[model samples]
Target: MENRSHALMTGFFTITLLIAAVLFGLWFNRDRVERVPYMLATTQPVPGLNPQAAVRYRGLDVGRVSDIDFDPKVTGQILVSLNIDPDTPITRSTFATLGYQGVTGIAFIQLDDEATGSPRLATNSTNPSRIPLRPGLFDQLEKRGKRILAQSEEAATRLNELLSPANQKVILGAFADVSATANAYRALPQQLEPVIARLPALADQAQGTLQSVSALAADATRLTRKLQAPNGPIERISGTVERVGLSLEAVGNGVELEALPHVISLTEDTRASMRALKNTMNNLNERPQSILFGAPGTPPGPGEAGFSAPTK
Candidate 1:
């Protein structure tokens, strides 16, 4: 009976061990899938990333990063394999980016769903697009601060060189010269005020002289207009003066007093000649008709009036 109990106990323990192993196996395979015939048609490597990490989408485990290896043919190109979940659908525009998860700084792939209008990305595809990761603002600011510090150090060195003894002397000398110039300029106003004050009196005197000159000019203009008046006394005086001038000019040219009798005689002779010419012309005009026909018998000479040249 004891031997029979021992056999039964041993059998029970064996069954329990098998059951435990099976449960453990089921638990382990919960996250693991059968190695399906997945293709690695394309792959992209992100720098500064670990290959053993899992690729996640919205905090869900989507794929595992398979390996990191340099391309044998393409120098400087790193190829990474990602074992994607067979159920996870990605589009042609789907891309991979690397980022740190939480505070560990361990990099992971962030798979994005881009299947809205894009075709499904084929599996086992090589040459998947690599999106460059951008540093955060704080990281950028840190880098910028380092650069600024370096520049500031350089600028300080340059400034220190410029502020050496010789440069200090030059700057101080310039300041001294500027101060002396300012002092001289400040004193000049005191010396110049009297000179500037006299200018106003000089200006007033000049203005008064100008006023007197204007008044004189106005009087001159009035006198000139008076002299030009058409029938004013000035015009008559001008005419008398002109006549006197002509008389003086004539006398200077030796017009003699004795020539007056000859001139008078010529005038009288010309008058008589003019009268005789007029009489002669009058007679010549009338004599033709009178000769052709006797004078129209109007009591011709008192003796012949009644006969009248036979009244022809």
Candidate 2:
């Protein structure tokens, strides 16, 4: 009876200890799995990311992707559900991207935060809480690789066409011509020796010429700047012209202009002298010496006929 009691007691104690241990373990891990759900919708390719893949925020492991499926509301859109730590500071500014581990190519969710002060989002009653997903570096590289492959395909086709038999024949003919040209220039070394010998002097002259050109350019730049300065030659010349215009305006306003057509009249005595001179000239042919003297008897004083006494 005593042995039976002891054995029963031993079995009950063992069961209770196991149950207590299990409860303690559950209590210890209670905070470890306090996951908050978040949804991500994207049209971009998310390569190699599977459920249970790690979700990293700023490269630190936070939680894991829980599920991936197409959104029922939006056709052709992928919805990735994540279960992150409740304590994660996933504000409105937080973003998620796909990432790859270096050599393994294992994809994960990489989270980054933008510069915003928005509050942390809570699970919506009507809809799953959503986060935005942008294209990752691997996505960009894959797209660029596709483009490069397409370009390479086109280049390969072009190259095949370019190297066709007929094109190759033409290229060979061109090569032959080039060979003939090269043969023609077989004596070029001897001919070029003199020219090559003078190259140093030519280089020196070129250097000097370039130096002169540089100096000239510097001078031209200086001249241009001097001409363009606010109080430079252009401004001074304009000022001088303005001053001259003002002076001319002042002079024009100060001076008085005279009237036109000032005429002088001949006097009566002068008219009488002219008449006497005309009569002398008329009788000049009759007696040439009368010019030095006067006409006989004062030319009969103006209008009377010449006094000749009594003509015979």
Candidate 3:
């Protein structure tokens, strides 16, 4: 009987000690800060999120998720309840999103305020201020997965078309043409060898022609200067023209003054001689024997000193 009693006492003491230890642990880990309740409603899926998930205010541990359930009032809507510290500065512009802890897939509530000057959100058990739950990175990627897959398929189809047999043949043909062009370029220097060899002679000929042209131009310049000189060809020709003009004037004066009167008097003497010669010719024609006798008697008229009226 004493042994049984001692065993019971030992068990009771052990149980009491365990209970005290648990109580002390609970007291040490208890949260002393006053918290405000908030609700998050979303229609988007919250993967890896559950009750007791940590709630962070801009990366700071501010609270924990208390509950997650479908909204009883709205169909297809989820409601998440959070108990955030009263000093967390939750406001009307504060919002929440689901975030993951690295690659673990563990989700938490990330709280952030869009406007710092927004009015404080007031809440209680009866009605908590609702925060909008926006789609997380994973959720957005999942939603766009189908569209991304469609675009990838389109890109693959285009790549296949580009690598088709016909396109491959065309590409090979273009490479062959490029090789031919390279061969042509390699042979071009040999083809131009003859022309290159003649370049020195051509250069010498061009230099000679240029020198000749330069000499001709210099001669033309000298001739132009001489023509423009005061005592040059132009001046000599002008002086010659003035002297010729004076000589012509002198000849004209002499012709009009001395030569003109002499010519007129000579013309008058010639006229008288012509008249006497004409009379002598008429007398000889009337008496043809007078030419041989060298004489002709004058016949008198009625008014003469030896006036004779001859009978018929």
Candidate 4:
């Protein structure tokens, strides 16, 4: 009975200690501990990307993924729930990116709180958006392989069509026509050999002609300068013009020989008329012809005094 009591006491103490330790641990961790809810939202099982996975806010343990579920209508999209601290107001600008912690490929939820002025997310919202950033290489490779397979199928169909007898004949005919055309053009260079050979000589002749033209242009320029110099044809032409002007002035001022004779005759006729008038006036002055005559038949004869005495 003593041994039994001792054994019972030891077991009781041990059980009590274990319970107290558990209670103390719970009390100590209660403030930091969080409950994460889980839901099957995604059509595909994102294993490591679970609600119980750690939700880091800017590398701090701010929250955890709460649940994941799929909509009844939409395919391939997983609605994820994140349970963040109530005090942590996540805004609309807040982003959630699915990420892997390490090489272990253990996926976790990373909430980007670095975005400024983010609004808080509602808890009752059924649909929560996640940034599509963590598709694995296998997923990308699978999509790429599907696209390549589709392209290969199309190529195979085209190849089959092109390999048909009619297409094959057409391709052969095209090849034959190309070969004939090439054969025809093969002699074109040979036929143009003479023309090609004459090109260099023609170019040389053109250069020579250009040089000769340059020499002739220089000579013409020199001749133009000579003609423009002092005592050239221009100066000679000016001198000739001056001389012609002087000659014209002299001719205009010179006396006319035809009018000289007429002027002389006019002067002689005027002098003669003046002399005749003077002589007539002198004779009239010398002879006083107021004689006493009878009224009907009195005649003034050579002896006018005799008639005067008879009249007296």
Top candidate, metric TM-score: 3
Per-residue lDDT of candidate 2, residues 1-312 (tens digit): 999999999999999999999999989876456788899999887878999899999988999998999889988899999988888888988888899988797899999998667798787435668889988887788899999999999999999999999999999999999999999899899999999999999999999999999999999999999999999999999999999999998777655332121212346567889999998677887798876775566455445677455558
Listed in order, each prediction's TM-score against the native is 0.41, 0.49, 0.59, 0.43
Candidate ranking (TM-score, best to worst): 3, 2, 4, 1
Per-residue alpha-carbon lDDT of candidate 3 for residues 1-312, written as tens digits (9 for 90 to 100)? 999999999999999999999999999999887888999999988889989899999999999999999999999999999999988898888888899999999999999899778999899988998999877777788879978999999999999999999999999999999999999999999999999999999999999999999999999999999998989999999999999999999999988998888999999999999999999999888988987997767777879889878789
| Clash pairs, model 1 backbone | 39-124, 40-124, 41-124, 41-125, 41-126, 42-125, 42-126, 43-126, 43-127
Top-lDDT structure, candidate number: 3
lDDT by residue (90-186, candidate 1, tens digit) is 6666655566767767777776654567776554444443433334334567789999999999999999999999999999999999999999999
RMSD of each: 17.6, 18.2, 18.2, 17.2
Error of 3 at 42 (Å): 2.0
Relative to the true structure, how large is the alpha-carbon lDDT of every model?
0.72, 0.87, 0.93, 0.71
Which stretches of model 2 miss by more than 4 angstroms? Answer: 1-33, 45-47, 102-106, 116-126, 188-312
Q: Model 1, which residues run further than 4 Å from truth?
A: 1-48, 51-150, 206-312
- For residue 161, model 1's alpha carbon misses the true position, in angstroms, by 2.2
